[model samples]
Target chain A: MGAAGIGGGTVNLYSWLSQFFGDPDRRHGPDSIVHRVGEHLLFSGEALGWALLLAVPLGLLLGYTGKAAGLVTALSGAARALPTLGLVTLAVLLAGVGDTAVLVPLVALAAPVLLVAACEGVRSTDPDLRDAARGIGLTHRQVLWQVCIPWALPALLAGLRTAAVQVIATATVASYVGLGGLGSYVVGGLATRDFAQTIGGALLVVLLAVATQLLFALLIRYALPAGLRRARD
Target chain B: MIRFDGAAKRHPDGTLAVEGLDLTVPAGRTTVLVGPSGCGKTTILRMVNRMVEPTAGRVLLDGTDVAQLDAAKLRRGIGYVIQQAGLFPHRRVIDNVATVPYLLGWDRKRARTRASELLELVGLPPETARRYPFQLSGGQQQRVGVARALAADPPLLLMDEPFSAVDPVVRSGLQDELLRLQAELNKTVLFVTHDIEEAVRLGDQIVVLREHGRIAQVADPATLLAAPADEQVAAFLGRDRGLRGLALRPAEGIVLLAANTPLDGWTLAVDQEGRPTGWQRSAETIRQVAVFRPGLDTLRTALDSAVLSPARVAVAVDHAGRVIGLAPRAAVLDALDAAGPDTAAGITATGVADGR
Candidate 1:
C-alpha cells in the first residue's frame, strides 16, 4: 500500500511541475525536480528543528518525574489519534495558516512518541541498580541524572528516531494547509490530474524515509553503549 | 561501643519486628546477633545506622543517641554491609569500595587510592578493582562489599548475614578474612547471621534472639554454647553444641600428653623441658621415651594419637608431670558421648583454660 501510494504521489508531482515550466512539449528537466527537492529539504529541516527542541525537554520531564504521567499520556494519545488533516486545521485556526500550522501539529505528534519512550526507558532500568546507588549514598537527583538518565539513553534515542521519521512522513500533510512542501506538488497534481507530479512527490517522500532511517541508524550505532547494542542484537 | 536500650520496632500494620531489646556491642570486639528467620536480627543491625528507626527508646553509639545524628551522615560514619553484596553493577569495584569515602566528601583521587588499598587488604588483587560487580563472582563481590565498608575506616561495622549468600567454602574463607581483619583493625563490629556455627566461629560475643525479637541470651561464644538461657536458645544452638564447642576451643591448653612416653604413631615427642621436638609413629616404637607437651595439641590431635597408637592411649602432660591424664580411646569417646544431646551449663569455662 505504501509503495503504491508513493508511486502515485510521485507521478502527480512530476506532471504538476511540467505545467509550471510551461512545457506542453513532453520533455523531462532536472530543474523542476531539483526545485521540488529543495522545497522538501527546507520543509523537513524546519520540522526537525522544531521537533527536537520541543520533544527533548518534554521527554526528559516525563521520563524523570513520572508526575502527571497519566494526563500527559492521555493528551499525547488523543493528539496521536487525531487525523493529520484535523490537526492541521486546528493548528491553522489557532495560529493562522502557514508554517506554524505545520510546525505545531508535527511537534504534537512527535512529543508523545519521545515522551512515552523516555518514560518507559527510565522506568525499565534495574531496580537493583537503583538500590545499589542509594546504598552507596547518592542523592535521589544524583541517581536520576547520573545513573538513570545515562542508562536510559538507548531507549530514549530509539524513540527520537521514531519521532524523526514520523515527522518527515507527516510533513507532506502540511501542504494541505498551504505550507508548501513536496506534498504541495502532490495536492496540486491531484487537482489538475497530473500523474507525473504525484509520482514525483511520492518518490521524494520514500527517498526521505529511507535516508532518514539510515542517518538515525548511524547515529544510534555511534551513540548507544555496546552493551545495549548487544542486548538489542 | 554500641548500645540498644529498650529498642522496639513496630511496623505500620502493627507487626512487631523487634521488641523491647537491650544489648551492648563492646568496642574492639565482634558481637554477633544470631537467630532464626523473622527474629529481627537484621532489624536490630539496621537500627544501629538508623536505616530502620526504633519506634521506642533509642540506639546509642558511643553514648550519643543515633536518632539525633543526621541519617546520611551517621550512615557514612558507620560501615554497613548487607547480604548479596548490594554492589552497584554500573560501578567498578574500586568505586564501590570507595562509596562511603566518596559520600563523606573525600577527593575522588584519594578515595580511589584508598579503595585500591582496601581491595588488597581484602585479599583481592588491584586488577580486580577495575572490574564491574557483575563481572565478579558472588564470593568476590562480597569481599568487595566488605572492602567498601572498611574504606572509611569507620570505628563501627555492621554486617547483615554478609556471607549467607555464598557457598560454604567461600563463606569459610570470608569468615577467616573477617577474623584476620578484626584482629588487625580491632573495630567494634555487630555481625548478624542465622547460622549458629557462624556465630560461634566469628563472634567474641553472641547475642541469641528468640522469636518476636526478644534476647534469649548474650554472652561469649563458649558460654553461650555451654549454657543456653533456655530451651529456645538451646534448640537454636542445635543438638551438636558439644562438637561445635570443640571447634571454638583452642588446642593450646586443652590437650595433655605424656612426657618420656614411648614413641608412637601421630605422637608429638617433646624434650624434658616440655617443648615439642618431633612426631612419632606407633609402628616405630622406641625404647627411649619422648615428652609431649600441652599447648601444642588439640582434641583432634589427641584423638588422632589415640587412634593410631597401639596402646590406644594419648597422654596429657604438663611441663613437670610425666603424664597428667591418659586419654584412652574409650575416655575420649566417653567425654564426647557424655556431652551428648544436652546443653551443658558452664562447659565452656570448665575444661579449657583461656589461652593467650
Candidate 2:
C-alpha cells in the first residue's frame, strides 16, 4: 500500500479510516493501531504525572504564601511562548533519541499550565472567605487544607484538563525521537510516502485530546462539593 | 471584661492606627467603638481576639493577657462577625454555623444539633440549614454569620459593623434581632462601627473615637447624644441628637387619658374592633392616624405619633394592637420630663461643655 498508492499517483482517504478503526492484519501486536494508541496515552500520562508532581505543590505553596507571584506569572508566560517541537528536537540532539528526550519537552509543555492553574486556583478564592477562615479559629495549615485547597480544586482540575489535552496532542512528537506512539504512524508513513497512515495518525491524536477533555469535565462536575459547584457559575 | 491597657498599634510603615490607649470593655454588655473611616476602631476590635497584636502594651481578657494565649485558641473562644458576613460559600448554612463547634472537636451530630439551635436563635427557619450561603438573601447571610459566631457559645463577641451592609429596613430588623439576642445572651460584646446612629441604637456604652483611635467621648447612648464632649463630638453626634436621645428612653410612665376624653374640637373615631380609624373634626375626617404602644414603643415614636395625629393626641395601643387609651402631646412632654435623670444629666453635660 505504501509504494503502490504513492507511485500510482493517488491517495486513498477511505483506506486510512479503516486502519484507524482497527488494523486487521496487525491486530494484537505492538505495530497495531491499538498498541500505538496505548503508547500515546502512556507517554502523555508519564509526562503529566511528573508535571503534576513537580508543579501542583509548588504552585499551591506560592499561592498559599502569596509569595513570588510575579515570578510564577513570568515563568508561565515564558513557558507558554516556548516551542514544544523545537525543545523536543533540541533534547533529542543533546541526549540522543529515547523516551527521556520525548518526555522532557512534553513535561515542559504541561508543567507551566498546571503551575499557573494551581497558583491561580488558590489565589482566586474570595479574600473574605480567607479572612473568615483565619478569624474563625482555623490554624494556618488548617485554613489551607479545609478552605483554600477545597476552593481551588475546580480551577486546578480545569488546569489539569487543559494540560492533559495539550500533552496528549503533543506526545505525537515522541515518534520523531524514536519513541513508540501514534506519531510513529505519521512519521513512518511520510518516510514511505503512505498518506493514509499519516492522516490516520493525526486523527488519532485529535480523538485522544477530545477524550481527555471529557474525562476532566466529568471529574470537575462530580468531584466538587455541591456548594462549590453552585458558587462557580 | 476586656481591658486595653495602654494597648497600641503602629504599623510598619509608621502609621499609628491606635495610640497608647487604656479602656475597659465591661462584661455582659455591648461596648461599641465608633468613629469615621481610618479611625482605627476596627484595629481596636481585633485586639481582643488577638487578630491584631498590639505593638506596645497589652490587651487582657478577663485579666488574662490575650497576647500570651495562642492566637487560634484565643480566637476560637471569641465570636466574630464582620460587615459582609464572611460566611464560607463552599459550606452549607448548617456547616458554616457549625464551624466553631467543629473546630472545638465536636462530633458531626452534636455540632449540627448545636448549629440547628443557633440557626433558630438567629431567627432562621429550619429549612435554611441545608441551603448554601449563596442561596440566601444578604440579611439572611448576616443572620447565619451571627449564628456561626455563636456556635461554640463564646462569652465574647467582636462585631465590626455587622449590620451595616444591609438596607435601612433590614438594618433596623437586624438591630432589633441583636437587641433581642443580647438581652438573652449578654455576651461581652465589643462592636465597631462608622455609623453613630447604629452606635446609639446598639451600644450600652459608646466610645466615640477621633483620628488614631483617640477617644472623643465615652458615655451611654443617651448621655452621648445629650452631652457630647465637645464641638467635634457634637458635630459628630449630628444636629437632631436631642430628638435622638428620646429614642433611647421608652414611653413608659406616661399618663394616658381615657379614650372617651374629647378634646376641644377633634374627636377620635374607632372601628368595631376598638382600633383607631381616624380623627374626625366636625364633618371633616383625617384618615392618617398615627399610634404608639406605650408599653413597648420609645418616646421618639410616642412623640412622633402625637405630632402626626390631627387630634394632637397619640393613640396608645395594647399588645393586641387595639386602641387602649389616648395620650396628649402635653402628656408625652411630661413623660419626657419624668425621664428626669436623662434631662438633668443633659443639662449638666451642657454646663460641663460650657465650663470647658
Candidate 3:
C-alpha cells in the first residue's frame, strides 16, 4: 500500500512539474525548483524546532513525576487520536489560521509519544544504581538530575526522533486549514481537479518525512553517549 | 566509647528484633556482635547509627545519646559499611569514597584528594580511582566501600557483615585489612556477623545473641570459647569450640628453654641454669614448646605443654629462661585425671588456673 501510494504521488508530481513550468516543450526554469525546495526546508525546520523545544521537557516532567503522569498521558492520547483535519480546524479556530495553528497541534500530537517514551526509559533504570546513589550520600534531587536523567538520555532522544517525524508529516496537513504548507498544492489540485498538483504535494510530504528521520538519526548518532550509541552500532 | 543501654526494638508488625540489651563497646578495639539470622545482631549495629531506632532505650556515643543528634549528621560521623558494598554505580571509585566528605562540605578538590588517599590506605591502587563500581570485581568494590566509609575519619565504625558477600579468600583479605586499620587508627568499632569463627578471630569482646533476639553470652573471645554461658551458647559457637579455644590461650609467660648443648637421639635433656629440657631434632619436629616462668606459668599451660609434646614431658624453667625441673606427662595426666569427670569444672578451673 505504501509503495503504491508513493507511485501514484510520483505520477502526479511529474505532471505538475511539466505543466507548471510551461511543459517539457520549453526549457525548465530554476526559480520554481528553488521555490519548492525552499518551502519544504522552511516548513521542516519550523516543525522540528518546535517539537524538540516542547517535547523534551514535557517528556522529562511526565517521566519524573508520578502524580502528573497519568493526566499528561491522557491528554497526549486525546490529542493524538483526534483526526488531523479536526485538530487543524480546532487550531485554526483558536490561533486564527497561521503558523501558530499549524505548530500548536503538531507539538500536541508529538509531545505524548516522547513523554511516554521518556517516562518508561527513566522508570526502567536499574534499582541498584538508585540505591547506590543514595548510599553514596547524593541528595534525591542530585540523583534525579545527575544519575537518572543522563542515564535515560538515549531513550529520551529516540522518542524525540519519533515525535519529530510525526510532526513533519502532520505539519503538511496545516495547508488544508489555510496555513499554506506543502499541503496547499495538494488541496488546491483537488479543488481544481489537477492531479499533478495533488501528486506533487503528496510526494513532498513523503520526502519530508524521510529527510527528517535521517536528520534526527544523525543527531542521535552524535548526541548520545558513546556507550549508548555503541549498543545501536 | 559506644554503649547500648536497655536497647530494644520491635517492628510495627510486632516482631521483636532486639530485646532489652546493654552493651559497652570499648574504644580502640573490635567488638563483634554475632548471632543467627533474626537474632538482632545487625539491628544492634544499625541502632548505633540510628539506622534502626531502639524502641525502648538510648544508644549512646561516647556519653551523648544518638537519638538527639540529627540522623544524617549522626550517620556522617559514624562510618557504616554494609554487606553488598553499596557503591554508587555511576560514580567513579574516588567519587564514591568522597561521598561523606563531600556531604560534610569539603571542597571538591580536597574531597577527591582524600578519597584517593583512602583508596591507597585500603590497599587499592590509585588507578582504581577512575573506574566505576560495576567495572571492578566484587572484592575491589568492597574495598572501595570500606574506603568510602572511612572517608570522613569517623571515630566510630559500624560494619554489618561487610565481608560476608565476598569469596572466602577475599573475605580473609578484607578481614586482615580491617585488623591492620584497627591497630593503626584505634577507632571504636562495632562489627556484626553470623560466623562464629569470624567472631573468634576478630573480636576483643564477643556478644553472642540467640534466635529471637536474646543475649546468650557476652564475654571476651577466650572466656566465651572456654566457658559458654549455656548449652545454647555452646551450640551457637559450633562443635569446634575446643579448637577455637587454642587461639585464645595467652602466650605470655609460656615456657621456652634454650638448649645448653647438643645432645644425640635423646628426647629429654637438661638445659643451662639447671632446668630440665625437652629437645627435638629441630623446631619443626617439636610439636609444642612449654614456657616456664618462675612462679607464673599456669598448670593448664604445664599440662597442655606436656600433652602436646612428642616427648610427653614439660620442662619447668626459671625466670632466666633456663630449665629447672621436669613435669612428666604422667604427672600432668594425673592432674587432669584428678579434675573429675565434670568438663565444665575442668574448664572453669583452667580459667582460674591461669589466674582468671
TM-score, each model?
Answer: 0.75, 0.94, 0.68
DockQ scores for all predicted structures: 0.22, 0.74, 0.16
- Top candidate on lDDT is 2
Q: What interface RMSD does candidate 2 have?
A: 1.0
lDDT of 1 by residue, A1-233 (tens): 11223344646445544544444322344335565556666766776677667766666666666676777667778878967778889988898978888877777778778777777777766775565456555667777876777667888888878887888888888778776667876786676666456655776777887888898889888866444454334
User: How would you encode candidate 3's per-residue C-alpha lDDT over A123-174 as one tens digit per residue?
Assistant: 6566655654554446667667866786677787778778777877777676
Q: What order do you get sorting by DockQ, best first? A: 2, 1, 3
For candidate 1, write residues B34-77 as lDDT tens digits: 99999999889988887788999899999999999877677777
Off by over 4 Å in 3: A1-86, A91-104, A114-132, A180-233, B5-8, B12-14, B19-21, B53-56, B248-356
Compared with the true structure, all predictions reach lDDT values of 0.73, 0.87, 0.71
- Which rank order by lDDT, best down to worst? 2, 1, 3
lDDT of 3 by residue, B1-356 (tens): 88778999999999888888777888877888899888888888878877688999888898999999877677778788888877665567888899899889999999999999999999999899987777788899889988998999998888889889889998998898988888888887889999988987788778888865577777777678777888888888888676456444432333333333333443544444554444666543443456544345545567666666555566666677666555555665455455443333333322111111
**Residue B22: error of model 3 in Å?**
3.7
The positional error of residue A231 in candidate 1, measured at the CA in angstroms, is 9.1
Per-residue lDDT, model 2, residue A4, is: 48
Of 1 and 2, the candidate ahead on TM-score is: 2
Task: Provide the global lDDT of candidate 3 against the true structure.
Answer: 0.71
